[model samples]
Target chain A: MSDIYTNNYVIVAIFLILGVLLPVATVSFVGPLLRPKKPTREKQTTYESGNIPVGDSWVRFNVKYYIFALMFVIFDVETLFLYPWAVAYKELGLFALVEMVIFISLLIIGLIYAWRKKVLEWN
Target chain B: MNTLLQQAPSWGTTLWFIIAAVLLLAVVLGFVTYAIYFERKVIGWMQLRIGPNRVGPLGLLQTVADVAKLLLKEDVRPQHADKALFTLAPILAYAPAFAVLAVMPFSESIQFADLGIGLLYYIALSGITVLGVITAGWASNNKYSLIGGLRSAAQMISYEVPLVMSVVGIVLLTGSMNLEDIVKAQQDVWNIVPQFIGFAVFIIAAQAELNRTPFDLPEAESELVGGYHVEYSGFRFAMFMLAEYVYMFGMGALITILFLGGWLPIHPSLDFIPGIVWFILKFSLYVFLQFWIRATMPRLRVDQLMSFAWKVLLPVALFNILLTAVVVSYQNGMF
Candidate 1:
């Protein structure tokens, strides 16, 4: 509103109009211009591309993937925080070192749980 | 915050904000558009075909054409779908792509935000995309989307660990979280020369995080039939496509920044190529390499995927971090 009311008004308003109208323009301009018009059952079908799609894609997955994923998120986030500590290493020194060790150790327990559960044992 | 803003130089801050936003938006939008094209071209080359030659010259404009076609298609929402969540999921999936770029340093001084806790912000923000996928998968109430979203949640969370650990070594060496500082440390020598193992681990984990190739169990067309996004059509579906390639380029850009020197050269003599150009070239190479790997490798079994991250990548990354700490400590003492 401020930009539209100020010296930047014209420029900002052009972008504003485009933002609202562009999608509408695209649908009309491009849809009819492209996509062949001879309506066939296959032409409109969700593109299996001449191959018959068999069996619904939804099926049970190994629940074990969930466990590993859970562990990954916890650890992934922990590692990310370490970047700041690494950067501030000079100012923080050994105090930072000790703090990181404690933090990493907490994440290691999740790793241990995965190992003990034998989720790591793949042939 | 208001007082701080009033006290500071507004021009430089505004300029940085604009530049960073432009770079971030351009990369996310441009990469997402072109990734589809690159994927087709690579796949076509492997299969010995011209590949979308009808669109623009050699199909250079094929993605634009495809995006246009998608926009025109019907955006069908299942009557049973939770309207609010259904409508919101694509934006949910896509918005994080832009947010994560806040932490990614395209070149020295070129970043959206230099929050002192940059790396942590990158990791934390990326996890938000999982919720978006889960939301899409759950809202559609399609069996396939539910399973796909479930698979995405599983795959990304699993891969995020090693990806973070891969950078732990670099952080140890640079002793700074500011991505620019990390890049500056590399002017003496790129971290890749010392942290080669970390670099390799990062690339592998990034591929998995972005759901490329073997780790793409979430969207495995042959198996789950388009996974979490199966119900989406037209522009909403295009949002998922956009989020995906943007994520890919984001990881590639992160890799370039963290491991490949973020536009620093092997020698000072090659400084003629501007830093941003060097960064972009490196990123493009990584993106191409991802396509190359996709054409060559087969998808892994679900069990194989979990075990590999837990047993293999985690161990290597942990070992790398410890080793880097010791080495960096010694180097610091010497200096």
Candidate 2:
């Protein structure tokens, strides 16, 4: 059983390496060989319609995205906890169901808080 | 495949895995190639146009020729772009998209990885692609690209919560995260019957996760101007496109496994047919639905997208979990 477990991960690791290698070989190596390299000044400018781009794009912008990320982290962590309990629900019985109910209700509370606080709003 | 896994760790097993991975990669590539072709043909037919009939017969090779054109074009990099991230972004995006397939059980014997946490593995790895999108936007030094990247990131993150929650009911019912177990759990009746709400939330969130139409505000060409990959060209751009289509394939297979009973025949009498054929048929239905919806639906407003995920889908998904738990426990004689 454990052999099957370890082997499952080993295959995944191999697939990961091959995944990266396939694109790198094709996009970086095989691609550059066939593609042109002419680099005029105008060709290298940041594309923003026909107009020349003004200033840098990496400027500090919206804080709303940060709020959304915060909410996602909270919910995502809560969801992760729910997974294990879920998988073991059949063995753990009604007691586990009750516990998960409290847990998920707590999550619902957090979501409701975010909604009430307007953290989920995108203006 | 299970037999090989049951054996002790050996060089032979690893070698077989590599060969399988390579073959699966080719299969995924073939699926993507045709998916794009069919998406165009399907959408074009909807729009009253012929759509790429100039390529190979019935426009079969249109995507191939387009890929060739993209490959041979100039590999452009803006002068002020962060050279490293610009180059690395595509690999990061494409790798995880492909890597998630490691856990995808195509047919029982054809599965590559049988990770215990197969479902979670897919969701977790797929999340990494969002980083690459954000990185490409920040690295591009283009204003539109940054906004598009951030918009897509927000959209993805918003939908991800519901997407993950939507599957909790399936895990609760099957009592295992291994996708094979989930499929087997549905041997009687598919999860779609009991878990219809999950199926609905999942399919909707999945559409948003893939950044397809209705949720395609990130790449609204009318505004963001080609989204995060605005500055990418040649094979680099192709990598991003490849990642999208490959992810579509992954999502389709996942939906089939979770709701459509993986490779199970609709009825026991139909067991004479191969499991893989049923798997492909169900998988094709999903892929075709994606194209059909893309042709039919318009893009949702950005605010509408965000609010819908949080206010509507999240609560509905949470309710689904509670509902599934109640039903499953009652059936298990725990009520």
Candidate 3:
């Protein structure tokens, strides 16, 4: 990569490191110095609205989230395709328009299929 | 900063980059502190109640005081919690929220990283926050936090589609994902006017993505009991709070860039005002709208939240991109 391009990301990398450092420093080092450290067994127990906790929380959650994740992956890929096309749209002109229309319509059809399959519903 | 981007790697440039990043972090922290104070004051006034009067003048230092208290409180971890992930979650969530600001052009000259794919950088980093939320919930080993985390993950991902799709209209119009180019392309007219459908979809999806009221399903307090951070206390909890507000700041700046014409005065005659002032004015309008909506709107049902994103916002965003593409091609005499 060119100096400019490489330098741009260098700035971003610095910012990311600083971003991580801020919360880590505050929550661990700086905070530990100032904060109290009184921990009882009850205080460290998982809270369940003041009631005694029951089964483990790591049990299987509703499958709806996984369904949404599948839908998201599909649509997210569609979005990825759309972005590059959109960025190049001015140069590509009418040919790209027709192609994108066909592309999006196909995804809309997939969305409709999901709707019909009732995967979009919360229940 | 632009000049620095053209230079080869060196200790001097690296030191300058570090200094710039630190300065920007200070500014962001200032923004977060006052944003919380402003949100409380705005919502409190709307509810006809006084807010934070005991802190500094006109409650200006309310959030500062609150942060001090949070830092002083004991950090607690549930006994069964995954210790490493629990400790890591807040940093994971917050780092991206702050890092995304690197690409945000505060004015024509004020951006830090001048990445070509600035919009993509922002979107990609913001999405990582959902992972942090899921980790916090799973690591907490609490039922409410687990449900909250899953709900939030689902909500964030669902809205994220529409959010990215909606901006494709602007990307199509400007033919560039670099935010500076997008803003410069709006010299004649802002994207919101021609890309009205996209703007509408973007704002709605942005609201959901930020988890503001009317779309705040993941952290629904009444039912979920403080949601994903229910098990987090003290400085760790403060990290989540800071991330949420900082994300709001980022989204506000982005909306200003994509739709509101970042730092562009409404009229040529009004150009005497500095660009940064115009930027702040437009950005503050967005921040205020967030608070106003938070005060006014009721939270949506979980099912309603999911359906609305997939059904309403997604389709609208898709239609917007198609509409923008057709119009742009026609304007280019390609029809």
Candidate 4:
């Protein structure tokens, strides 16, 4: 059993390494071999609809994205909790069903809180 | 598959695994090539325009020609951009998109890693693509790219909730996270019937995940001008594009597995047609739906997209899980 688990993960690891190498090898080696290398200063400059860029493009973004990220972290973790319950649900029966209902309801309440706080509002 | 896994780690098996990975990669590249061709032809017919008849016979080789052009074009990088991250972003984006394919059960005997946690592995690995998107935007040192990346991050992460939640109903019904088990449970009937609502949520959330049509706020050409990939050129741009189509293939295969019953014929009487063909037919339906939507629907506004995901899809998905749980327990005479 342990051997299978380790082998499964080993296959995954091999795929991961191959995935990274495929693109990196193509771009660095094969791409440069065939692609042109003309890089004038004007051509290499930042694109701003034909106008010379005035300031750095890395400006501060809206705070709303941060709030969305925070909400995502909270909800994502909560979603992970559902997986375990779902896996064992058949064995747990009615008691598990009621417990999950309560758990989901509490999360719904948190969602409602965020909704009311206007954190979900894109603008 | 389990028998292969059971054997102690050996060089022979490892060699075979490497060969399989390479073969899968070639197959995916071919699929992406034709998918682009098919998308153009379908959309062109919808819009009353000729798609690509100039390349090979009936434009079958158009993607090949386009790929060649991309390979031969100048590779550009902005002087002010973060060199290391900029170079790494496309690899980051494309890798996970391909990596997740390892868990997808293409057919009964055609899967790679038949991990016990197949579903979770797919969702988790696919999520990493969002990080690559953000990195591409931030590294480019371009405002539009940054906004596009941020929009994608927000859209994908938000919709991911409903996407996962929608699948919970199926997981609950099957009582297993294994893709093969999920499909086997649907041997009598596809999950789409009992889990129709979850199916709807999954379709919508998946479109958003793929950044297709209505949910393509990240790369909205009008607003963000190619989104986070605006700064990329030549083969780098091709990598991002490859990632999108490969992900489409992955997502289409997943939808087939989860809802339509992976490799299972519509009717058992049609079983003589072969399982791989059924899998391809179902997978084609999803890929076609994506292009049809792309040609027909307009993109959603950022605010509207967020509200739709959180307010509508998420609640509906939760309700689906609750409904499925209730029905399951009732069926089992637990009530």
Candidate 5:
């Protein structure tokens, strides 16, 4: 593994070239055989069954989803720290338990904010 | 297979590793292409439709043909897009996914860069892939693309926490972040049995991390219309797809390493296949499972997705980590 990491630029170049080329090679070799000629405007349109697209692809979404996502961000950060501490639970014992309580309490506070805003509900 | 290179001081060892990694990377890349073919085939089967039967035998070469079309197609760059970032974004999207191939323990003899903190590096590198999405979105000056990219960055970053936290349970049980070492730690029993909650949370979070279905709101086709890569054309789009599939395999590798016991044969007392074979089998199974989930489930609202990861998965992961640490210590007589 150490030896693998120690390889220099020429090695790197060869690897990079292989990475770039193999996909290209696969395409070149196999493509012509499967070639389907593209003709008219119909071929270019995005496929949504047979009907033409209803509107321009772009559409506005509800801002409430954004609010819910924002609330999730708050709780998720709280959870990440809990993982490391959980691993050390045996050695840390009571201290870990105490700390976790404090951490979760903060998350609960955020949950309260979401509850008050009714962000958790589906519209 | 673990034989040390006796003949090498510097040049020879370097030459050997370089040759081997190049060979492996080629194989892995081919596997990535085939994986795309496999995904289409399997998903088609699940959806009860024929996929790419005409492209090659079993439509095996369909991805190859599509690659050619992409290459031959005109490169479409939006006029207002930032030239530098637009060009650079694909690399950002792609490279980290490949770099993660380093820590995945395909075999005891395999693995390119087995750093002690392999999991940490994998997560860190993956997180940066989000930046590429944002760069592509913001640089494009296209509003839909901008919203898509921003949505992705926000969604991915939000879920990243639970993703890492879920893995913390396995890391706790094994007492090492080096994937190979962690697998070896699970020599007695696969961590999945002991850490089921962590396993479940990790799998869900990983699905979200890959921006996969049910959790794929970032590329939500209904409203966003091709989403973050909306403006990219030609090979740039191919790069994004390739990166995504590679990362899917990478996630499979991580799940296998931490939870499925890496290369350790599932059957005790009888070992026919090498550890590498087990690793590949397990990894491929998980990858297929991802496709299955995609086929079966409906996309969740972005809000619901985050709450599921944070409220549901996060707590479960923490609980598993705590439980594993205690159980392992007591059993080992550490207490």
Candidate 6:
């Protein structure tokens, strides 16, 4: 059993390395060999539908995206709590069930608060 | 195969593992090539167009030719773009897309790593692709690309919650996170019947995760003008495209394992058909459904997309987990 566990992770690591190499190699080595490399001032400029660009594009974005990110962080952590409960549900039985129900209800209450506040309304 | 894994560590086994990884990469590359062809043909037929017949026989070589052309195009990096990050983003995105496939069990005999936490491994690794997308968008230094990237980040991160929640019902029922074990638990009945709501939520969230039609606000060509990949061209662009299709394959296989019973025959009496064939059939059904939806549906408004993920799908998925838990406990007479 321990052997298979070690073998499984070894294979996973090898594949991860290969996945990174495959695309990087193709784009850097093989791509340059075959593709054209001519560069003009106009061609190199940041594309804005054939017009001269304005100020830097890395300007501040809407704060609503940050709010959504916060919501995601909260809910994502909440979701992780269910996994251990799920795995041991049979052994833990109704007690675990009631506990999860309480936990989920609290999160739901939070979701509803966000809903009422129009945090979810996506203006 | 279990015996193979149990063998003592040696150079031969290491070589074998390397060979297997390469072969799997080849198979995935082939699958991605034809998946693109298949998507075009399916959507073309739906739209009453013949679609790409000029490239090869029945357009069989269309994607192949397209890939070659992309490979041979100018690899342009826009001035003022973050050059290092721009180059690195494709690798970051494409790597996770491929790595997630390591955990997908195609059939009983055809699996790579049979990790006990296979489902969690898949979900965790799949999340990394979002970083690549956002990085590509930020590194592009283009307004449209930045917005597209942020939009994708928001959409993927939001939809991921419901996606995970939907899968939790199955985990509760199977009592195991190993995908193979989950499929084995479905021998008597597929989870789709009892967990139909999860299935629906999974399908929706999975589509949004893939950033396909209706949820493709990030790359809504009509709006953001190619979205996050707008500044990408040549081989770099192809890597992003490949990642999307590869992720589709991974997601399709997952839906098969979770709801359609993986490679299990539709009925016990149908056991004469091989499991791999059943796996392919179910997987094709999913891929076809993606194309069908793409052809018929209009893209959702960005606001509607966000609301649907948070407001509609997340709650329904939560309800599914609750219902499954209650029913399973009752069945065990623990209530």
lDDT of 3 by residue, B119-161 (tens): 9999999999999999999999999999999989999999999
Q: Candidate 2's error at B94, in angstroms?
A: 0.7
Off by over 4 Å in 6: none
Better of 1 and 4 by lDDT: 4
What DockQ results do all the predictions give, each relative to the true complex? 0.18, 0.84, 0.81, 0.77, 0.15, 0.84
**Candidate 2 i-RMS (Å)?**
1.2
Error of 1 at B159 (Å): 0.9
Better of 5 and 6 by TM-score: 6
Measured by lDDT, the strongest candidate is 2
Score candidate 4 by lDDT.
Answer: 0.91
Off by over 4 Å in 1: A1-66, A88-110, A119-123, B1-27, B108-110
By DockQ, is 3 or 5 better? Answer: 3
Model 3 pairs whose backbones collide: none
State which docking tier applies to candidate 6.
Answer: high
C-alpha TM-scores of all predictions: 0.80, 0.98, 0.98, 0.98, 0.80, 0.98
Higher-ranked by DockQ: 2 or 3: 2
lDDT by residue (tens digit), candidate 1, B208-272: 88888878889889878898888787777877777787777767877788877887865699888
Model 3: fraction of the reference interface contacts it also forms: 0.89
C-alpha root-mean-square deviation, each candidate: 6.5, 1.1, 1.1, 1.1, 5.6, 1.0
Separately for all candidates shown, the number of backbone clashes (residues 3 or more apart, or on different chains) is 4, 0, 0, 0, 0, 0
Off by over 4 Å in 5: A1-123, B1-11, B329-335
Residue B96's lDDT within candidate 6 is 91
| Pairs with steric clashes in candidate 1 | A86-B175, A87-B175, A87-B176, A87-B177
